[model samples]
Target: MPSPLPADLTPTELVELMQRLTLEEQAELDHLLTAGLPRWLPQVGPQTDALESEADIVFYGGQAGGGKSDLLLGAALTRHEHSIIFRRESVQLVGLEERVARILGSRSGYNGQAKVWRLPGATPRILEFGSVKEPNDWMKYQGRAHDLKGFDEITHFLETQFRTLIGWMRTDNPSVRQRVICAGNPPTDAEGEWVIRYWAPWLDPQHPNPAQPGELRWFVTDEEGGDREVPGPEPVMVGGELMTPKSRTFIRSSVDDNLFLQLTGYKATLQALPEPLRSQMLRGNFMAGRSDPVWQLIPTDWVKAAMTRWSPRQEKGPMTALGLDPSRGGADKTSAARRHGAWFDVLVTAPGQVTCDGPTAAGFVAPLVRNGACICVDSIGIGSSALDFIKGLNLLVLAVAGSEASTGSTVAGNLRFRNKRAEMYWRLREALDPAAEPPIALPPDQELLGDLCAVRYKVAQLGKAAAIQIRDKDEIRELLGRSPDKGDSVALTFVSGIPMPGPARQRTAREVPDWRVC
Candidate 1:
């Protein structure tokens, strides 16, 4: 039995009351009002929650068969006046087109060539279906205005493409709500990993301050393209201007949330797929396909464990070294890391736009360089300029060039490196090993974690000797879609002969002190 509706309510009062109703209550009201008409409505659970979400950006799907595509179509059909749904390829829109045709009962309003559906109503809503496959394909919709933007299987598109498309999302109609809805499962490869960072509050386990599912968080982008989270959704002063932060939230969806899918035996089909795809699709496990590649120099687990041990209030020794990676200009960032014994402080970074020259980068690094702290600069390309300026100031500085010959080898002397870069990176890897002395602690910075774990290495035989060869920086930048500035700064702190402070362990006669490894 259900409660009777209040009698003689005004239209405005009824609308306000409907707005305050829970999803289930709203559904009951819809059932009573329409008298079971053949109108489309959101299926209960994730679909209803997604349709009702007020977030500026909402990530709506995780597991397979979660009614992700249906939710996008349903929202466009009912709520939006002008909307666009995107897929990685135009061919992928076939199923969605068929669904739209069935829902509309005819293709009379659809323009096949333009891929736009014009629904006749009081407002005459428009829905567009499109694809962005190539790098510059997103430019096709440069100045287009859309109130509702949908990206299905969002991880298939590059982060740059997704961000660029969202820039054009706008509408002047007050009654038309604006929102970005993205749907996807866990990334199947490294190229898709940026999605995890974009939704860090909900997806990233290593995020310093994790957010609960569907919790609204506000973020504003700084000049250097880094996002800074503010306390609330209110406007804040940034660079002498009032900037409003956008609200974002992620809602996890699963097969169980879709009653129709559950009854259709789709879960069994997902279970039969090969791992780690099975885990990704069945349980929506984000870590499923993230197994360490064979050539990955630093394991993800090792970096995560080191981050877990880090604390801002932990006791620290004197600053042993400061690593500086300068960005001359362009999109790269100038980053610095301060090392205290085995503990590393959070990375400090400025965009290339601000730190454009050597003097500017030096200004940022000067405060961190104290007495007895060796300022280690990459000294390659623009970094050479910063190194020269630091040396002129009469401060102790170490110039590190990746192309230089390795000055040291492993404790066993069996592992030789092809270049100084290989040796320095390997030293950091050894320090992060489970049994390494003076356990390393790293700040929980998601960007730094990604950079460190992105590197790949190989053992090459150089005639009579085998030398470890690290993949070139250019190659790494291509893979990561940005410079590995943070990782480079951290690795530079391990320049040879720099002593780090840590707990001393009594050693047997056969044991050699492990201090040199750090």
Candidate 2:
């Protein structure tokens, strides 16, 4: 329950008082009263709900750069006397200490000798910062009482360490509240795996759980202590009275949810990571059934290097072409990219308009089409309408059907490419490969690079023949936060080996765009 209003003040008076307060004063009041401090990002605001709720266990985590650390720091910055923070080492706490100092007006009231903060107007608040480096370290707080305790990364310590701390979290003063805060990224080790198990109902899909990203859930139990999802059937008959259940919740976060981190290009670094690690760190693909060792279509490093390849910034092909992957609503992204031939380097990549109706998308790209640029449109899902819309513009167009792309079976230099989409993806790799004469360039987009790198392929047997099957958009969307629309938009550029959109200029040059039919 939220904090009650002051006994002497009515709702109207409280509203009037709130109206008179400035934004900074309101923020500080919110922080001091309800643990509602905010970080540089808004998604983390839900975490404050998790912190303030009356829960037996609360965990916040999932992906990196979610401002979890700063949250823990802010939660610990209260005037309580018995608040403590735990990390793997004391040096690890220094950064948080500096952050708290800046947040608390740069006042260094912490007395290192006593392990307490000596704010002038308040009682001497004991803030213990301890290290749980080994199993024996859990005993350090055996005799102490902590009203508030926070774990920087719970998985870094043994399960025993966490359980021991639970006992120490108690308060004798009626007005003082007891709370626990823990923050971490996805666990990468056995200890982390243990945490997932300990909180299986909250983290695992095997159980029927009712927790949302920030919502708290209450649970009761019988004598055996097994968690009860719903209570009040018999109320556990605790001492002939209705017993209340404790609450617990988990709040998930990712780099995308943190706007500040996104601005710093942290996502590109996560995307550049290698396979299973990349899936775990970037996509938060925890305990999933499988992650193919690779995209099977292209390597991540190759695309990353393509993003870094030195190329003239202002080069324009004799003719330009547009790649459009249309989406309607909800989770889909209407990605569109423009590239110049014959090198076929991407120049710009962006999302199309709202609703992404065929006509709307057609209108967005009509000017480019009128500039004599051919367009390769994904004629799948909402894209079919988009294709017709663009075609209705009386503009040059190449349609990439999800069904299949090639007229004859063999394509792209005698390779039995599965379908048009596969053929285009493979040819895109060929175009970007450094070994290929006249290496191509691509837009320096992190998401575009990540999606391109994530494409995978597999060979299938059809009795007497072998064929390649590319990973589909739905499968790709599961790993990527959204559909790989941008990547596919670029892939569409290779739909057909049409001549570079200008008068013939390079039949004799090795570095010129290849004018061959795939």
Candidate 3:
């Protein structure tokens, strides 16, 4: 026989009874409060009672130990009869499911029946927990749509993987709006370009001050080349105005904002970190590892002063070859230089350099040609544009391919990109040294240092596990944001044919003499 119902109770009566649960339940609530709501907790709380707009997307961010999981579960519990919490870590997901089962499992409805719960709910079950750490597991999300979706530690999963899972959130109920809530800490790498570009606009530099949530939307370009806004709630608003059609909302939370993190544990955890991870995880700096262990090849001070000297100077002597590196639209950078057996910064043009969309290769090329500098640029993809401007000027454009070698090789140049870049970086590092007088002084350009800093290495595969690799394109693009046309041009110039000075060509009749004059 079923137990008797608590009573025919009013909302106030229900609240009182709910509050008067057994000591075990009270202890669990206290544990939840301590973990989820402490003042030192790293995420925002239920300060706003209003239901969020049915925006197509939403995001939550902050340091770890913030009641992010609890908030996500609580939000879903509001209107979602069925939900799925997608956890990247199996351990975390299992722990959460166990907690939910224990907390909401025993409570009886007014009818004195056990609260209903199911993993794969019937007729499209309402609640399920899934993991996405392994690539194949994402298969579970297919053909199964839910009204609510929650992702914990979103950054750990690949962007493509996350997108695939979110496709399952569609539901048939008009009144039941679908929601996709994601929470994570800062990304672990600068190469995670998508994260910074998508989230930077809405995140506060400092957290715990309560930020309005933000959303980033995309549109399909119409046949006429005009952009049409995709369907969704008015772009999520912040500061009383709807975000731009392409804007994204990023909610920044911190330990203090959580109002639940224990002060002693938070401080203890922070102190225990080995410094770099602590800065990134606790302090929330995406670029924290900029000059750390991987980049320890060069000291920070060497490049700090080198950044102040790179600028255009009046042409001196015959311009040698110009090296070029073409980019794929504004997504890459193009670099150029006239090397006298040494690299020099001629132009650093890209999207990030100035707020524009296309290549400025011509602008850079025109000046070098007028100065009689022969240019060499990588014309792979969209870089073919460089050819149009290269005509009539003494220039050579080459298509350079990234290293095809695999990871784990020794003798440096075995991996294409890092081999060439390692040499270039070494030279630049040497030139930047304040201690050693450089054979040639480069004009200071922090942008170059920024690009150099952005470059990262990867283990290249070379049939055997003996080759290593690192590509500079990503880092180079961050500094220039378009493509390193000028950077590539410089490298090419250093390796290409020399430029003979104008009106100073030698006659065939003149015999060459050796350095030894007898």
Give the best candidate by lDDT.
1
Per-candidate alpha-carbon RMSD to the true structure: 9.7, 21.9, 12.6
Each model's lDDT comes to 0.82, 0.63, 0.49
lDDT of 1 by residue, 207-229 (tens): 77999888899989876677889
The 10-residue segment with the lowest total lDDT in model 2: 509-518
What would the TM-scores of all predictions be? Answer: 0.79, 0.44, 0.52
Ranking the candidates on lDDT from highest down gives 1, 2, 3
Cα lDDT tens digits, model 3, 1-518, are 53654666543454455456787986775676577542222232421211253444566665665556765666555557667787766666666665565546542221112122453333333456777666546786787778877787776665545656876767777877777777777766432433543454445233323235544444332321123454543464443445544323555545544433442347458657875778766776654653333644345445545444444556554455455554433333445555543335445443323211123454444444434445554544544555554542333334333332212223344443235444444444444567655534454543343344454445555454433344566544433333434434444443312345455322221122121111
Candidate 3's C-alpha runs over 4 A off are 1-58, 77-150, 157-180, 187-197, 202-247, 256-268, 271-373, 379-422, 425-518
Candidate 2 local Cα displacement, residue 126, angstroms? 22
User: How would you order the candidates by TM-score, starting with the best?
Assistant: 1, 3, 2
Candidate 1 error regions (>4 Å): 1-40, 88-126, 129-141, 188-194, 204-212, 271-279, 287-289, 313-315, 404-418, 459-466, 496-518
What is the per-residue lDDT of model 2 for residues 114-226, given as tens digits with 9 covering 90 to 100? 55665554555666678867555767778688887888877676554776676677888878877777877656532245466556666765445545665566656433222
The TM-score of candidate 3 is: 0.52
